[model samples]
Target: MTVQFERRTDRPDAEGRCTIHLRAYFEGQRLRLVTREKCLASEWQTDKQRFRRSKQGYQDANDYLDSLAARVQAAYRQLRTSGIEHTPEELKAALAPPAPAEKPKPEPARMLVVLFDEYRTAQSARGMRFNTLKTLNTSRNLVAEFAAKLPKGLTLAAYDMAIHDRLLGFLRHEKKLAQNSIWKVVKHIKAMLAYLNRDRGMPLAVEPKQLKAEWVDVDKVYLTAAELATLEAAKLPVGLVRTRDAFLFCCYTGLRYSDLAELREGNLHDWSGARVLRLTQAKTRTSVSIYLTGTASALLDKYLGEGLRLLQVMANQVMNRNLKEISKRAGLRELVEVGDYRNGQDGQATGAQV
Candidate 1:
């Protein structure tokens, strides 16, 4: 019945570290706990705390301990109410088939480490992006870390949707994760399920398909002709003129930046009349056969001749920066703020600039 969190602020690191610990005592010893460190230097900007690989802080540490207490308390309550006291390890042993009559050939248990490796290999074969793969590995590491805080038998896979909802709800509400971010975690869960079912040959882990993607009403805003013209005329950084053109090419072609980056000379259809670009989109695998529009054609004519990278557009950050400003200048039903609804390319008012 005891659930508690303790915080200890110490000057262990230059940034002022806080040890936030949450532990549950089920049978005298701590059953489960979570501890995290954060930096106080920046007034605890959460994204900064997360994204920056900086030092830890006392307040953030205390906060982590508090959250861990809450989660362990919830988990403990559910176990008590449902009468599910056996750890997954104990349950596994309980569910294990009886010692066979003739002493069957021994097959060792599949270690979690082995399961994780197979999961990564399978994901690689299935075409996961490097970053996506990296995120999955991180999630797996987090799960392992959290499980270790519990007993040896904490089976996350055995948890039902109720637990999933509890975890995600706490993550979104108490932890203040955006819906999109929770969905990012959901993606990791899905990857783990894939590893479990397809790779590990396990059954009845949390079903990911039952989980919905976080809803977001998108306001698609591509540049308009006048806006594009204005953007084209805008001052450039040291070497970003080509990058702008390349992004513009994507705007016209509906190709993602990934597809745009990988397009090669070999894919360029020179044999066609008047410089048509023939290529399949990297993301959707949809083939695009755009027969040179006047401006887009001119861009290809210039860049293809020089043999420069189609993506030499310094970076996507610059593209987004310029686009945001350009949208504001064009005044699309008022300047496009971060969350404002703006018309997408499909239907634009006659004078509307992006």
Candidate 2:
């Protein structure tokens, strides 16, 4: 076996210091092991296989290289004395120091709800949208409630196909959740499990694929053009006027409620002889530019003096409550049938007033 000290110029640290590696060649096989010694490329002597004498601490560094070579020679002689066949990899392993014993790690949080909260916090730190976080919170609460009903309570190790089936049954029968709502809850659970398993390197007791997120297409309800005009003309109490205007602005510009809540006067700018609203969407993190229509521009003009925010958008829950009342007064109370499917069969249809 031939052992030589090599200065690895290809691998340099941020400070431009490269490590000196010990390379061993035996029987046409080679093994490279990194040493604790480091120096600049100019400080190393290729012919001498050591740092230049001009470099400070060159004597000590060269002594370390000599010691490493002695250790390699000792290992090779020991292997030959045993009269056993060995490879370059075996010689490299024999030269390596013993690894330090690992300290015992505190047990990680294993309860399903606790893990859910931890996952939510991680996602929030990564800039998840408020609406999406709210949905995750809801899913966490639903899981907690279902766990409360279990005989032994829910733990990460206890999650399996049986638990998945029971949770679905609880949502469908006990909680009376719609098919799509159940699908969303299931989706959130799978997402949390996937994050824990793949990103955090945690072992999953149950595969997320086994927990299916089955969704059924449902008819979406929205106001017609005639209904929008009627709502615009309808007289409302002073309390509901702001909510009505905000809703109409969304209808005109197709902006999501989250984007409207965050819209500011600075977002409105003159572009190519026309006014446009430009902002990054909260959910998708995508830039959007919408040309202002006559009605949409008029609504913004009405709220011009309302601080830096273009619209005095209220909390989503309160705004939704006010919308129901406003829509009722606007004569948009046509009854509609909302149908859902379950297990590939037609399920119950519910009547809702639009």
Identify the candidate with maximal TM-score. 2
Report clash pairs, candidate 1. 38-56, 38-57, 39-57, 243-313
lDDT values for all models: 0.55, 0.83
lDDT, candidate 1, residue 236? 64
Candidate 1 residue-wise lDDT, 187-219, digit = tens = 776766766876557874467688665745344
Q: Which lDDT value does model 1 have at 221?
A: 53
lDDT of 2 by residue, 2-75 (tens): 88998888989998989999997777878788899999888999988989977789999999899988898888
Candidate 2 backbone collisions, by pair: none
- The candidate 1 region of ten consecutive residues with least summed lDDT is 345-354
